[model samples]
Target: MFGKLYLIPVDLGHPSFEALFPTLNREITSTLTHFVVENQKSARRSLKLIFPEIKQGELSLLTLDKNTSELDLNPALDWLKSGKNVGVVSEAGVPSIADPGSLMVKLAHAQNIEVIPLIGPCSIFLALSASGLSGQSFVFHGYIPIDKAEKTRFIKEMEKATGRNQAQIFMETPYRNNQMLEDLLSVCKEDTLLCIACDLTLPNQYIKTQTIGKWKKLKTEDLHKRPCIFILGN
Candidate 1:
């Protein structure tokens, strides 16, 4: 029989493993020596933090990022087929949601491997829960377009959908956060509800929802290097 595929969740900027993950999750992750990760360096660091007794050299890590191809993931599958339990972790948050680790999950299902999802922080759901938006019916548009014109159009369309009672959630690269905010203010209606959830699960975490008109009056600073989630509602 093939070993199960564990969908591991990492801290969302929390200080320690105990703070974000349950004891069971840590225990499961500790026993697994094989991991399919988005980034090797960060993955190793996270594993060490979760299981301090772990020997870094003993763990096997396979990179699965945007650039990873189906051919590149076969080796990781081979480990599962060999009866070694494998863990899938993202750079942050839950594996396979916004990250490319979904590919592995799909393959696991195809091969009849049991996939277990461990609980932890997920910025998308966390932000939605706090935003007081229509969580019952919502859509998560992963990342806004990089181009100015295209992003503006995308924001406007999401706003229209939100006005129809569907909550719209999206994110932007940390460095482009301020720029994205600027475009949002310029393109979205003045009375449209907007929520900005920044640095979630961190000490300086900020989450607020208000109309675009209200947000325009506030003295905004740079969110140039902070992880953020933006939600729109009517």
Candidate 2:
């Protein structure tokens, strides 16, 4: 077997998070020589909260701020050179998917490092599971366009995909949830189903499923600031 380079997902710390925590702690204590995080401060806070018993000195945390497309993973590269196992984590959700850790994963693969992933709660999966959409085939578009014209074009394409029975999953920044919903309501047909999976695994969590036309009638301000996963099916 090869040395492990664990790709741990620490998004909202869902219920499954508690179960995965001790396993992560044990792995860190036993095999982790270094950690690569998107944000050092948050990583430290999370570590202190979840694995307070683990000594700080045993882990070397490297903070990465570059976009996955622009990321220069020299720090992670150097860590692996020392024959020490390195772990990559994002602030939320699985790292590398709509997150910056993809670059590191790509580099690690090229360098022949064994990349191991731990199963945990993912808002996307949770959303899809409850969306009542076809799961056998789907596409995660990551994010929709910010520009009106671009977004319109994107929605048209998404409609085409879903109309043929493929589930479409996408996300947006928390504050823009309402606008995204509005755009979807305007572009999608009345029969199109929309699933808004917000703040999964957190208190006051919400999963609302409705047709595009019906969703427009609901007030947006009522929805709190939440990490959300949006799904559309035709």
Off by over 4 Å in 1: none
lDDT of 1 by residue, 40-102 (tens): 998887777777788888889999999998889999889999999999989999998877789
- Candidate 1 local accuracy as lDDT? 0.89
For each candidate in turn, the TM-score is: 0.96, 0.86
* Deviating ranges (above 4 Å) for candidate 2: 13-30, 67-72, 217-221
For all candidates, the clash counts are: 0, 2
- Pairs with steric clashes in candidate 2: 11-92, 11-93
> Residue 47 CA error for candidate 2 (Å)?
2.6
> RMSD in angstroms, candidate 2?
2.8
Clashing residue pairs in candidate 1 are none
> RMSD in angstroms, all models?
1.2, 2.8
For TM-score, the strongest prediction is 1
